[model samples]
Target: MKYPNGTKMIKSNYKDNFTSKQSFGNRGMTLEEDINATNNYYVETDRAIIHKKPTPVQIVNVNYPKRSAAVITEGYFKQASTTDYNGIYRNKYIDFEAKVTKNKTLFPLANIHEHQIKHMESITRHGGISFIVIRFALYNETYFLQGEKLFSYWNDKLKGGRKSIPYQAIKEEGFFIPFHYQARVNYLSIIDKLYF
Candidate 1:
């Protein structure tokens, strides 16, 4: 009788002396889920705090089939107004977005929204560590491209360059985030090396 609303009260790794890393991970879990697990692990270990911003929604209609069970029938995503994940870590601010693509050769810059770019800019203005973790699913490679790097190339594209960031560029300009058991993405390691 477990209805998957994702609001389930799952225990965090910090609850007990859960020192042992869990082998559990999303079997074909979306990149978002993998990042969430990693963030959960970080939060539990008192390492760093990061969270996915809730998707904005505009609820227009609802149906109350039962007194306690009202269902939303008509609604739409209010366009995302900010970056995907961000928070404070070790008394410093950390901001980032996670994107996954099936492409092998390149990552289309078009896939990133302008608003997200602006948000990352704001975070940088405040002296925060900002980055984007891109997963090239086709090659099973994940790279953490610094916000400054992305911004530089983004401006390059605006000044009449390639419409996309080639994978070779990413590999050369970005750091590979190591994957872990409980902390699936383990991006903080990359952050530690590149930022801290």
Candidate 2:
């Protein structure tokens, strides 16, 4: 090829046809983002209505440098958030918390709060579907752990037992959620099998 300046471009020996192996992973997308996309897809298709619960924040100060622009200078959480998400699926109330951990061997119980556990318990008691979406980022795998199973582990930890749930145990007991193009975190499928 010739340049506009009348200079000849030299061709290098780099392979132009080389292709890298395609990976079926989430590709740097966070667990929340994946779940949000999945929820969007569900809402768009009239499959279910789910959304990320916004944390209650008390905006103490706001700076309005310009009329069109406002910046939140100070804010505080009004209350502790119960869970990450809640919605209705197949006429049943769905509530869950989404957590991502880098640990490969186990999921630390410290990541969850006590109040959240109580809330989840209440949800289950009220005939609602309650669960947690745990993502092992190291393995690129997500699992749906039921509230009842989680409560047992929490109780064990409180009773001077293991502080974390083993990844192998979760694999055996929890349901794995596979990634899809539209439903990146297809957790609804697990609900379908277990609930409906």
Candidate 3:
């Protein structure tokens, strides 16, 4: 499968060497898996209630062998999703999308869709906290960029501005998520500092 950055994700022959407890390093686990683990930790601890939204699928065909389980033979996405994760934290609604890029210099704006941007804007308009979690996989750094800041870049791009947000700009405007043993992404710590 190809990642949003247009790079194909090949099955790694080294995957079996690492266990879940030892997968925090840059090459060990993917950004998505790390964040999901972190969210699981948060839920188990009752610190927050966040979850990855399941992609809606439209099943076109199914097959059933006699007295056996059914299998989906064909399916397609129902529609474009708004974001990846959403839930409540500190009595306020929290919503955000997570993305990973191998690019070291800039995060391509094309990684975000227009409808998703609008959805984030709506969240902010309704008093919910909205942001994006971006991981520069090559650098092993994750950042939380607020929706307003993202909108600035999206707007600029729409007006013929730069097509990508420079890494330096993100470093300046975004909050760095510290990695920890219990919380892999540790994004709630940043939310605590920024939103709480």
Q: Write the residue-wise lDDT of candidate 3 on 17-121 in tens digits.
A: 243333335347777777888999999999999999887889999999899999988887776668889999999999999987778899999999999999999
Instruction: Tell me the whole-model lDDT of each prediction, alpha carbons only.
Output: 0.80, 0.86, 0.85
The best candidate by TM-score is 3
TM-score-based ranking: 3, 2, 1
Clashing pairs in 2: none
Best-first order by lDDT? 2, 3, 1
Indicate the TM-score of model 3: 0.86
Model 1 error, position 50 (Å):
1.0
Error of 1 at 140 (Å): 1.0
User: Model 3, residue 82: what's the lDDT?
Assistant: 87
lDDT by residue for model 2 (1-196), tens: 1235434323321121122222455564667778999999999999999999876889999998965789978987665658889999889999999997878799999999999999999999999999999988777789999999999999999999999999999999999997889999999999999998
lDDT of 1 at 151: 93
Worst 10 residues of 3 by lDDT: 13-22
Clashing residue pairs in candidate 3 are: none
Cα error, candidate 1, residue 110 (Å): 0.6
Q: Using lDDT, give the best candidate's number.
A: 2
Report the Cα lDDT for candidate 2.
0.86
